[model samples]
Target chain A: MELVGISKLNADYEAAMAVRKGIKLFIDESAKENFKKAGIEVAGTKVEMISDSQIVIDATPDGIGAKNKALYVSMKKPAIFQGGEDADVAEASFSALCNYDEAKGKNYVRVVSCNTTGMLRVICTLKNSFKVRKIRAVLIRRAADPREVKKGPINSILLNPVELPSHHAVDIKTVLKDLDILTMAYVVPTTLMHVHALTVQVDGNPSKEEIINALESSRRILGISKDSKIASTAEIVETFRDMGRIRYDVPEVVFFEDSIHSSNGEIFLTYAVHQESIVVPENIDAVRAMSGLKEKEESISLTDSTLGLLRGRLV
Target chain B: MELVGISKLNADYEAAMAVRKGIKLFIDESAKENFKKAGIEVAGTKVEMISDSQIVIDATPDGIGAKNKALYVSMKKPAIFQGGEDADVAEASFSALCNYDEAKGKNYVRVVSCNTTGMLRVICTLKNSFKVRKIRAVLIRRAADPREVKKGPINSILLNPVELPSHHAVDIKTVLKDLDILTMAYVVPTTLMHVHALTVQVDGNPSKEEIINALESSRRILGISKDSKIASTAEIVETFRDMGRIRYDVPEVVFFEDSIHSSNGEIFLTYAVHQESIVVPENIDAVRAMSGLKEKEESISLTDSTLGLLRGRLV
Candidate 1:
């Protein structure tokens, strides 16, 4: 694994820096001096890194992945793109819960954005248990990462399009082609977590216990504190800190057991996705799926266990 | 406006103490000394408080309200009861959003609880804008009020029935006779707020803007900050603090403008009801309704304005 960047991050990059091994920085000449000064080793250029690696995860700034497609094509190696990249850069959008098969035997897979992944994790978990008639999701997104201090309208709330369905519904359709989804997206000032409030209308009446059981069955969904002790995302981050997570990152979807409500056939609930680590597991699973080294179930299970997804309470 | 209580509270009672006028404590001999020592004047027995007032608002504990009905009955004064009282104790349950008119000329009115009020606010707001076919709500309730440290399983999540459709649906029907609602209740350890996640299946495909406009039309609904600055409820409380609210209480339902998502007649979103202040506005409206001094519109408007409910962001 290699950490490839075009230049030195405007500020310290904690998420990338937290990786202690199997990571060599492939940065430009301008960033090389800063890397060495910071007591970090630097690898060759982006072109050399692409050729040397078995798999490339293009996590560069938005639109940059599409620009670097030629290098990956030259190597004929499997590459994964982050949400910031357009779907055109890859054959199909990837969500571990939505379309694992799409990633198999593929050279390019674009992992869906953080918000979309959270919605997929939830909708996919319950879709099999109940007949989903419709889905409406509200994405309360973080305006900027904690480190990106200069990036936002810190006081005002901006609604994208001031309309019904935002790009999220369109992005979700890239994988869940048949499902009907309407997404409303808003970027808030908070840099902590992105919260998705979802309502899925399913056919027939499902019991609350039934809905809880269905979600609990999913290994990827980690049930966080339902007890009020950890009420807000700030407290939730603190819980992760107290749990002694290496980078204080919760890669899995965190939901409240008490928040699960099923009435008649409709389900309503709220869940938080850590913008920093939600895609990390999907990236690992995509590697296995793209390499064709293991089956979907084995790959997902291996990713979940290795990532400590099962450490939290189930319900 | 009367602060008639059985005794001096063991802990600080911010809500009650915040009232500037028209409060009299009615406590027994045991706690009467504490009230006088705290420089508070004491009224006579429960019977005197019920008899002397033009209208009585019974803030007594559960079962105790039923027991004290004899006192209110003797005076024939219209009394408002909290949710803790049984249905038999009151003629009908009261929510400002639901059955406000029913409170008129009623001898006994029961104001719904905090969690119920939050759901009712959202449901009533939407029901008017769209034909609601079905509703499912999950109540992430506060285990105990901030003042009631003695009353809770503070570290554990408790499912009241360990099944579907807890008492909230049954209670909702007591006010809304035709609503098809199912509510699941769970108590979390946090004392800050009770969060309600609601999903409604409506008759037509409504746009997100239409749904948001409906809620914003209601003065009691306060759209809070969505940007990174005020991410958590802790910060929301601080926002109220900076605004110089009397009790640091948010009497209105705090939701996000970006959280309104509607597609194919289904709407989804999450909002937090400050457990300390949610019922306060309802209680105020209930008094006006019970006393028959004003119509429903005037009563609700007067309550909202007097409580500064219109001060927060509308959208």
Candidate 2:
């Protein structure tokens, strides 16, 4: 499959291509001359870029995706929307592990938010092996992304909704229809990652080893042991940087192996979710499902392998 | 009661008195000359300060309290220890609201830690009006005191104990002997306050107003309404500073009035504990309890009045 970028802004298009593989093409001599004068080569955009592409990934800012959906629908093109878009903006809220089949051949698929995506991977992975009952999660959320200067709590922990079961849990229920889950969230001063303290109850009593094995087997979950010395999100990002991960992006859900504790059919564990990149792989899989190009496992494996995720201890 | 500062270091003595009300007295000419040359009339410590004092407040560092126990015991002085000391170091681990009776007339009374003190005030207050069966609290802790530059996760949310029921719960249990409570803690990048998300199971189905009334009636717990516009820890400190509070200290537990929700014998609420000063009132009460100067209610009322706590909406 070929990839192309389209944005009203030339800089946005350039940024899109820089993160992926694409040839820098100049649309006009003026555009080329502008870059030459600045002593830098640049990429350019075309008016018919959307028309030329088979599918569109509406990666625009939040409400913008809903607006762009009209254009995509008018063109009769299948589009995948980011988590920012509301559920009504898409035919279905997508999670590759939870409901990839629901997105197959659909015109619009909205991959749930980063936290929702991270949770789906773990919950769905567990559901695949056990009769899951209920879950209570306390989300210690990052106040802002590292690049975000305007957004803040700066040195405060704010209750995101100041209420019970933040939107992420409700969002999860959008896909996993009957799952019993409740989430409480607090936004803390950190841009690295969001940490979740989860307590799950299942039908059968499972050993800690069995639970760990089930989670570890998932290509999208990276089980980190205590001995790794990659204790906090800072060390996780530092390890990713040391390992030469692009943008220090850890697309996989980081599960602390030592944090797993199971007793009397109840399991307790904690994991860190990279809010920026946890949904990237899900978006890739969503693209495949929307295009009807591959089966669920096939798409997930392809995306994981392409992104070099779950390649053992990241440290 | 007369207060005397007794620290081997004059600087430590000065800092202690600066926060409290005491006249600066120089013990030696050299010390007086040194302060005069520095353009400051500083308080000096006498070698006989401990012997001359009726009671001692051991504010030394953690294990140092245990070591200092030997000296206090040798001096035959009734002393009240800070939370830093172990339970074994004192005759009782005390929270004014929880175990003031047990601490009464005791020579060595250890005021529980800041977090424990915060929990005890709320729990004991609730236990006063209702039979609390169980409690599960998620403690979002401040990484360090604002004045401490040496301590940090800086930009990370660390699981204080990468396990369930962090030390705070265990510490709380030390005082509330048979109270069933489970606590989880994450240390975030904030030095202002520790936010607690508490879900308490009670024997009776109390109305939200009843619960709020019980909590507010406690002089040590300050109920903050949403209308006050004090949303997070930063705003709480700012409001205190605006109120001309000494050192911007909020010695009361700041409970969010709007965060309280009651359903089917369960109470869910969130409150902020100013880690620096939440225990100040408790410490004052502890001194009175240890010295047998006042009974439980009398000591608490006196301390609350002296600290100017629970006056009204701080904002």
| Tens digit per residue, CA lDDT, model 2, A82-146 | 88888889889999888999998888889999999999989999999999998878889999998
lDDT tens digits by residue: candidate 1, B1-315: 554443334313542463235555565556656655666666665556655677777777778878778877877777788887777788889888877898888888898877777778878888787889887665656666767859754433344433357788887877788988877665544566666656688998988667767777876787654453443455566678887987688888877655556666767666778877888889888888877778888888888777778634632
Candidate 2 wrongly placed segments (more than 4 Å): A6-47, A311-315, B6-21, B24-47, B311-315
lDDT of each: 0.71, 0.80
Measured by lDDT, the strongest candidate is 2
Please give the range of 10 consecutive residues that has the lowest summed lDDT in model 2 chain A: A6-15
- Report the C-alpha displacement of residue B90, candidate 2, in angstroms: 1.0
Candidate 2 per-residue lDDT, tens place, B1-315, comes to 667754533434354455355554434344655545545445554436677788888777788888877877888988888887778888889888888889877898888888889888899999999999988788889999988889998899887777576878888988888987878788899888999988888987999889888987777788777777766888888888888988898888888777787877878888898888877787788888878899988888888777677743444
| Model 2 interface root-mean-square deviation | 1.5
